[model samples]
Each structure stands twice: as C-alpha cells, then as structure tokens.
Target: RLFAEKITGTRRDRPELARLLDHLRSGDVVTVTRLDRLARSTCDLLDIAEQIQAAGAGLRSLAEPWADTTSPAGRMVLTVFAGIAEFERSLIIDRTRSGRQAAKAKGVKFGPPPTLTPEQITHARALVDQEGRTVKEAAALLGVHRSTLYRAFNKQEPTP
Candidate 1:
C-alpha cells in the first residue's frame, strides 16, 4: 500500500501542500481524491500542474479522469481552460474599473459618509479642549463615538 500524506487546509492556503510540491522529485506522482479538493480554482490547478511538470513530477486526480497531468492531452485541456478562466477574470476587472471611473466622473463617493461634518467636528473639538469638557461628554453632545471625537481632535491639534 502506498502511504499518502493527508494534508488539511483550504486549497488556497495549504502550506503543507506547497512544501510537498517543492520536495516532489522525478517519477513522483501527486494524487488527489478530487480536482476541487486540490485546487481552489482552475487557474490555481494549472499553475500547480505547471510546477509539478517543471519539477519532473506528475499530477493525478482520482475522481477526474481528464485531470491527469501525466498525459499530453490532459495537460493541453487543463492549460486551455486555465487560459480561458484568466481571460474572464481580466475582463471582469476591466469592467469594474470602468464602472468605478464612470461613477467618479459623476461625483459618486465611495465608502461610508462621515459620521459628523467638518463644522460639527470643529465644535466637538472646541467643547473638549476650550470648554474643558471631557472627551466622553463632547462625544455625547456631538452624538459620535468617543474615539471618533478623539481622532478629530488629534488631527486639529498642533504637536508641542
């Protein structure tokens, strides 16, 4: 019986798998129960296969007959699919960037709006510093978090 090492972790973040791959030698076959169990995505799958091939090793999926990296046809098919997946990801990124640019051109702001306006912040700072009010008191009057009020005050203060 062949002793198979059981590695546990998300396929995307398996340090053990990476170490195993690095130590794999020629004639070594890395076998997995399933294709998805080994790779998080098709691109990741192809990259791992390329690494194995570069190291003179092969990959085999028990559940996926077509995912055999030991065969030329399987390698070609996997490479083609990975290329398609990468192209799709690039298209998605381009569309998202263009969309964000269009929104920016129309004065759309990203992230949460400020909890308190600049004038409110200034007043809050005055209450805490000039009026000798506690940070908690000033924050309560401004209807903001104490940390938020403190952050605004810190930004307005000049270092001694």
Candidate 2:
C-alpha cells in the first residue's frame, strides 16, 4: 500500500500519513522520496521514525539512504543526526532568548500597545476614586471593559 500526503510536510497532522502508519504491519517499510517530504524538522523526523519503529515498521528515505531504520548502521546514523539537530535547536533557542533580552535592555516594548493613554487612565481612576462613579460606568465611558479599567488602576502606583 502507498500513502501520499497532499498537505505540506511542515504540518504533522496529515491524514494520509496517519492512515499509513495505522495500517503498517510488521516488516513493512514506509518509503518517502526524500526526508524533507516526510517531516519539517529533525525532531519531527525522529518523532515519526519512533512512531514507525513502535508500530513494527521501518522507515526509508530515498534521498537520505542513511535515514533507513532497517539496518543497524542506518539506525545509528539517524540517532546521531537527531542528537545534532536537538543541539542545534537548543542553540537557536538560546540565541533567540539573548536577542530578546538585549532588545528589552534597549527599551524595546513587546506586545500590543496600551489600550488607553496615561491621561485616559488617570481620568478613569478619578472617575472611580474621586467622582464616586462605578467601575463599570467609568469603563463604559472610556469604551473599554470594566476588567481593563480595574487592571489599569491596579497597576498604577499610589499617589503621595
């Protein structure tokens, strides 16, 4: 039986791939034209390979002959490659974290801009604190949710 995925290899939820894996019997070899056609990343490839192995089936890639799980040498090579891929992914994560930290130190703000300006927040607080208006009324006047106004008030430091 042959299985082909119509969706991009980047997605792991391919119906054909699932059906193929489910139908696999012992001694069955699942073949792909290339390793990239099977998975988006090395981790994804390893995960799929593990699934195939668990189902008592073998995986083979024509473009990457060393990726075959049928032979001991091929299995060893795949394991080594998986290790390297994991290390590379960790390095990438570390670099990304460092970049974000550096950006933060430079005063770069992340996430959506504040819903209300400082003046609007102050006015809202006054409406609730000084004018004795209800939080819901103030929020309605400001065109924001009551919870948003509450959070804004909670975040502000007390005035001396």
Candidate 3:
C-alpha cells in the first residue's frame, strides 16, 4: 500500500511514490485506509487510480469495502464511481469559479483592502512635510510598518 506524501508531511519521499508505480505488475493491489485519506479531492483520487490501473495494478479502498477491481462487481462499481468522482470534481471547480467571478462582478475585494486608510495617508504625508521625520518615524507613530506607509502614500498607483 502506498500512502501520499502530503499526508505524511515528508515531501522528499514523493520520488518513492514514483518508484512504487514503476514496480507494479499484473494482479498487484494497492490499499488505502480511506478514500479521503488516499486523496483530498475527487480529481486527485481518480488520477491516482488511473495511474495504478495503467501500471497493471488495482486499488482497494478499505472504507469503501467494494472497490477491489479483481472481482466483476468490483470492476463495474469502480468504473461507475470513477465517472461519478470526475463529474463531482468538475462540478466543484465550476461552482468555485462561478462564485469568484460573481464576487468580482460585485466589486468585492479579493484580498485585504489597502493597509492604511486614506485619512491615515494624508496625515502621514503631512508629518513627512512638517517635521521632516523619516518614513519609519511616521510609520512608528502610526503603529504600522514603514513599508505600509510607503505603499499607501509614497508609491504611485498603476495606470489603467
């Protein structure tokens, strides 16, 4: 049984997964604890299963209890489930993309708004003019990073 590196948190062993794939032969079986443990997403699960089948190996999901490809019923169920999983993944991707597009159309900011408010920018720039303090001194007084002050007032906005 081959476990994914992402779960174990030891990424240097990914090449070991490649080696396991290379060593597969006919009638070999790969087992997993659970479907999600084997793969975080449906696309990832289907992709790994396809790779195993291509290498002349079969997959057995312990939690699924009926995914063994050696049996006729198991093979039938696998074909149907693989199709279902792929469809489910595509649906999720489409939904996520649509949601993001809708948010953008509504003018909802994708990330945090400008770190400093417009009022703060004016005050900071004034301090820079009146007292001749360094940007870092004004930023320290404002309780923000020096880079935040620079990004808010010193840097020019990009032109469309």
Top-lDDT candidate index: 2
* Per-residue lDDT of model 3, residues 1-160, tens digit only: 5535443422334555666678788789987777666554566666777888888888887888887766778778878977898788799899999999999999888887777877788788878877798899999999999998888775645222
In candidate 1, what are the lDDT values of residues 1-160, reduced to their tens digit? 1434365434356766778787899988888888777777777777778888899988889998888888998888788888898998899999999999999999999998878887888787677668999989989988878999777766765423
Q: Report how far off residue 52 is in candidate 2 (Å).
A: 1.6
Say which candidate scores most in TM-score.
2
Rank all candidate structures by their TM-score, best first, as comma-separated numbers: 2, 1, 3
Query: How far does residue 95 in candidate 1 sit from its true spot (Å)?
Result: 1.6
Candidate 1 colliding pairs: none
Checking candidate 3 for backbone clashes, the offending pairs are none
Question: What lDDT, from 0 to 1, does candidate 1 have?
Answer: 0.80
RMSD of each: 5.4, 1.8, 6.1
Candidate 2 residue pairs that clash: none
- Candidate 3: worst-modelled 10 consecutive residues by lDDT: 3-12
